[model samples]
Target: MESLIKKLSKSHKDCPECPSPKVVHSFFESILGLLFPDFATELLKEEDQISEKIEELRHKLSRILIRNKHLHDGDGAEIAHLFFLKLENVYDLLIQDVQAMYDGDPAAKSLTEIIRCYPGFYAVAAYRIAHLLHSLGVNLIPRMITEYAHSKTGVDIHPAAKIGERFCIDHGTGVVIGETTEIGNCVKIYQGVTLGALSIEKADADKKRHPTIEDYVVIYAGATILGGDTIIGHHSIIGGNVWLTKSVPAKSKIYYQAKMYNPASDETDTYIIKSEG
Candidate 1:
């Protein structure tokens, strides 16, 4: 009986195909070494000269930040150190995403595929890097990183946004998540989805400036959810190409339809309201 139990409890050891876990750490170190060469070299002895080039770029950036007053009450050396530390956290978050993508999606057959082919991964990676700079008060650099991701993936996620675990962004293109947006765990968002602010010109910077999405919500492609006060209830489904600004009830469905109108005749034709709920 004991032998049978042991056999039952034994785990299968499969072939390791992807290096998603290690890649993020190594890439983070590489990016950091490229960003602050002297510091990276000093910290990591017997390093490549790539660290030196990083230091050169950092020196130029420090001067620019000082000139532009982007940093407050911190010296160039201190800012650089803080930025690196923040980036380290961001790198950890990115690794979490890599793990999530690897474990959750069957299509992610390998770590290499995830790193090279997944736009969602790239967008999240850029956001992680940018968020570090944002927290470090390196205003311009964070935006630049996020913007680069946006340009490449068509996914514009601001660095200041707070996102929870098991979040999946599918087909990532044309997805925009604003700075103040708060996303909960196990949320899935598709391409062309926008969690944006209704009042881009509003004066409420401290107040909520974007939508709050709860857990287990699925936002379909081309769905635009706007407003600071908008709250998407848990387990809700937002249909594709729908425009929404108001709060949605839990376990609800939403959609949109258009009808042709003639100004001269003052008549409407083929009015349609498409919805499952």
Candidate 2:
């Protein structure tokens, strides 16, 4: 017990001070609350109150960066200032995302409902915010924010992934977007979809390991598109339960067909891809 205690003490002493999980979650929630009326704890009555809240958020981010100062470059205050300067652009991108979700899904009743209740919106919002921080070279906290969304929404998106404008995720559970994944605009991905790497090799860590999804592509549920070289062309439809690792041309339709099995030839599998080209 004494040896274990001493080991734990040494580990604690060696670790650098970073923002706590609660602080990271609070920071994310605060940003959401500030941006949309649906998530706000209480509406700011005046313009001055809104400005003060924004400043408070900036201060919180600065303090978070300051705590893990060694993990990044430049002054924390300067980084925080730069982040705020670019925040409007982020808000604009999220607005586009919200529009995409509302336009794509028939079940969505209104814009406010998407903002308030959709897990896909929550997950993508976390990604956009974390992606901004990642761009500014703030390391650990960005990951924390994305992970918080992942834990709650079951929509796992890496902060470093490049997602284009008007992207949508429907029935978002079990969606995985990898670190190096690149997604284009007007793309809709359904539940149980994986944009992942073919290999988990450490040597490929620096390389683009995930697939590239072109614009206007709709990848339905249970579709697995893997490999860095794999690219799904624009305006294509990738159907459910389809597994793809090779590149397909534009306007392609990839799906499986359940054929009647041969009773005499010892073939048991009934499902086959009628055309995966």
Candidate 3:
């Protein structure tokens, strides 16, 4: 047992200190608290004390980055300051998302309700934050932040996915957005939707593996769109449970037409399905 303990200690000493998932999550929570002060009773209101909140957030971020060895003291401070400077733009995008959610869902009572109660909004907020970090070339932390949101919401969005403004994910549980997935603006996706790769090979690592979703496309629940070159064109409606690997043209409507079996009728036939376009 003593020998085993010594081996473990040696291994521990050899490994570099990775960023603590707990600490990263705490930082994520702190950022969210600043973004939505009303979510937490003790959080300082952004409107009331913007400068103080920014400073506190910047300090916390700098500490995390420095501790993780991702950046030097000066670099960490500069990055944190720059990130906060972009916070207003992020806030605006989040508001657009909230509005999109409210407009897309009939059950949504108001923008405030969407902001406060929607899991989709929560996931989007996390993704937006993570994506910003990813764009800034911050490693590991972005994935950690998105993974935290995935744990909470069951919406797995890779930080590297290029998502546009006004993106709406309704009933977002089981929604998986791949690293190379490129989604356009005004895209509405339902639960169990996967914008994924056809191949999971190691050689395909740097390639565009996931599909591209064009603007105004409505992807329904349980739809799996695969392959990097596969593009769901603008104004397309992909129906629930549809499995697609090929690209569709603009204004296309693709749906799975299951054959119906009427026991009394004694007629078993499948009809041709056509795109609305």
In order, what is each prediction's RMSD in angstroms? 18.8, 1.6, 3.4
Per residue, candidate 2 scores C-alpha lDDT tens digits across 167-210 of 89998999999999999999999999999999999999999999
Q: Where does model 3 exceed 4 Å of error?
A: 14-16, 43-48, 70-74, 260-273
Clashing pairs in 1: 37-51, 37-54, 37-55
TM, every model = 0.69, 0.95, 0.90
**Each model's backbone clash number:** 3, 0, 0
Task: Identify the runs in model 2 with alpha carbons over 4 angstroms from their true place.
Answer: 259-264, 268-271, 275-277
Candidates arranged by TM-score, highest first? 2, 3, 1
Q: What does the lDDT come to for candidate 3?
A: 0.87
Q: How accurate locally, in lDDT, is each candidate?
A: 0.72, 0.92, 0.87
1-277: candidate 1 lDDT, tens digit per residue: 9987776656322312222324334444446444334314445444565456456555654554555453445575667666654655665666666677777678788866776678898788777766765776665556666776787799999989989876778789989999899998778898999999888675677778799999888999999999988998888889898888888878878776667788898986653435453
1 versus 3: better lDDT goes to: 3
Q: What is candidate 3's lDDT per residue for 1-277, written digit by digit as tens?
A: 9999999999887655666789789888878877876464475545657677678778988777766654333466667777887878778888899899999999999888898889999999999988887776678899999999999999999999999999899989999999999999999999999999999999999999999999999999999999999998999999998888899999999987878878799878664445778
